[model samples]
Target: MKNYTTPILILFLFLVIAIIGNITISAIGLFFNHDVFNTGVYANGYEASLNIKLIFMAKAFALLMFIYSVYILIRNLKFLVRRDFFNNKLVQCFSKSGKLFFFSGIVGFLASICGILNIAIIKDFGSQAYLNIDSKSLYIMLMILGFFLLLFSKVLDKGNEIQQENDLTI
Candidate 1:
């Protein structure tokens, strides 16, 4: 397990760097692309007023949360590498990651709702707001995964206590 840790850490670091780079490039593009805010058909097959800064802000917030979750995962992996798998710090990191994931999902769901609302407001009965199934499902999945991660953290904490007792007995 120790021998595998270094390679896994390296892979995770590469993924973190890649995701950060993608986010940075996207931010730069959004900054330069004035048309991003213009009224247009979104990728979700809905027509909406895309010019609102709130839309961008929501997306940015969600992305940041995702990054934070990944960072927490990295911290958890660091504990594993250090052979501190059952430590409180590791459990805390897992808990934090779960919260971030849940929050990000909510942000994404709200952002989609905002887009639909924008369309309905601008069109004024001419257009109807439709539910975005993909976004809704993704958000639901993320929240579920986050909830399980948090539950796992509690199990880890219990395991840690048991391990400590066994160590002392030995």
Candidate 2:
């Protein structure tokens, strides 16, 4: 079987890009929707209006991000299910990464559910009754989660290295 390093690298890059994009969109959305930004903040409310648009845009982007995450999860799962996966370092790495990606997917799904619930609640109630989330706290949490994931990925890389060495010794 071919070495899994290339696929791992590609998947890693894809994940990093998705994480960065999601964070940016989420931060922008939170910034605009926050109460801190009054309606008349800039140029007769241009900033506020822009931020409002960004909020909806971020929601859409977030949904797309979740979809992309599922794609990554599936790709990694497929890699892990190969018959020689147990003996293959690359495959092992993929499995480790896949598990982490699976957890990430669960989180993404939860966030998506929350967003949907919020939308439904807003429809049933009104903006006056709706509560907005703080962008800074959300961003910090996401960044922390991303760092943990990165650490997990590093562990997977180490697994790959150990597997390769084991294979050579056999």
Candidate 3:
């Protein structure tokens, strides 16, 4: 069995907070406005449908993805901070993880946005609008994950540079 350290505890806490926040926001939206669903068509005559519950769910799911991404971010950040934000083992881990997290976050964020927009459009123009809810939601989640990966990669590159410099000095 492995022992849980402070950093792990912090990571766990962050995840809980993010997930809770996402769920809470979704519930709030669902509760406050239950009559926001409708069906409509756009200028192109495409069909679309929007439901309050769906919108809430999409947003909540996106937020959950975002939270996971953030956890990766915080993990890297914690490492950087512990390493004094320099080139070291912990920082290296952070740098790598941070990029991964950033990409994930971006993907999730985009997907969430797309889902939200789709719901909004369907609500206004009718459910016959031109957008797929399930697909968009998936993209949003991917976007979140992608964003984290991007960020982590960038940071890791920087860490590598610093490490090289230190090696040269030694």
lDDT: which candidate is best?
A: 1
**Stretches of model 1 off by over 4 angstroms after superposition:** 1-33, 36-51, 124-136
Question: What is the lDDT for 92 in model 1?
Answer: 90
> In candidate 2, what are the lDDT values of residues 13-91, reduced to their tens digit?
7866766565554445344444333332333333333323344344444434444544554555545556544334444
Candidate 1 residue-wise lDDT, 9-128, digit = tens: 788778667656654544433443322433333434543234444565575577577767876786567688777879999899888888888888888778767766766776432122
Candidate order by TM-score, highest to lowest? 1, 3, 2
> Mind giving the per-residue lDDT tens digits that candidate 3 earns over 1-170?
12445667677787687568546543533454322233222335433234544554554555555455556555555455454544355444544454544454454456556556655665443431212323454445555655555565567668778778898999
**What TM-score would candidate 1 get against the native?**
0.66
Residue 67 in model 2: lDDT: 44
Off by over 4 Å in 3: 1-22, 28-55, 76-78, 82-121, 124-170
TM-score for each prediction? 0.66, 0.39, 0.40
Predicted candidate 1, C-alpha RMSD: 6.1
How far off is residue 70 in model 3, in Å? Answer: 3.0
Error of 3 at 115 (Å): 5.0
Point out where model 2 deviates above 4 Å: 1-48, 83-145
CA lDDT, candidate 3, residue 9? 68
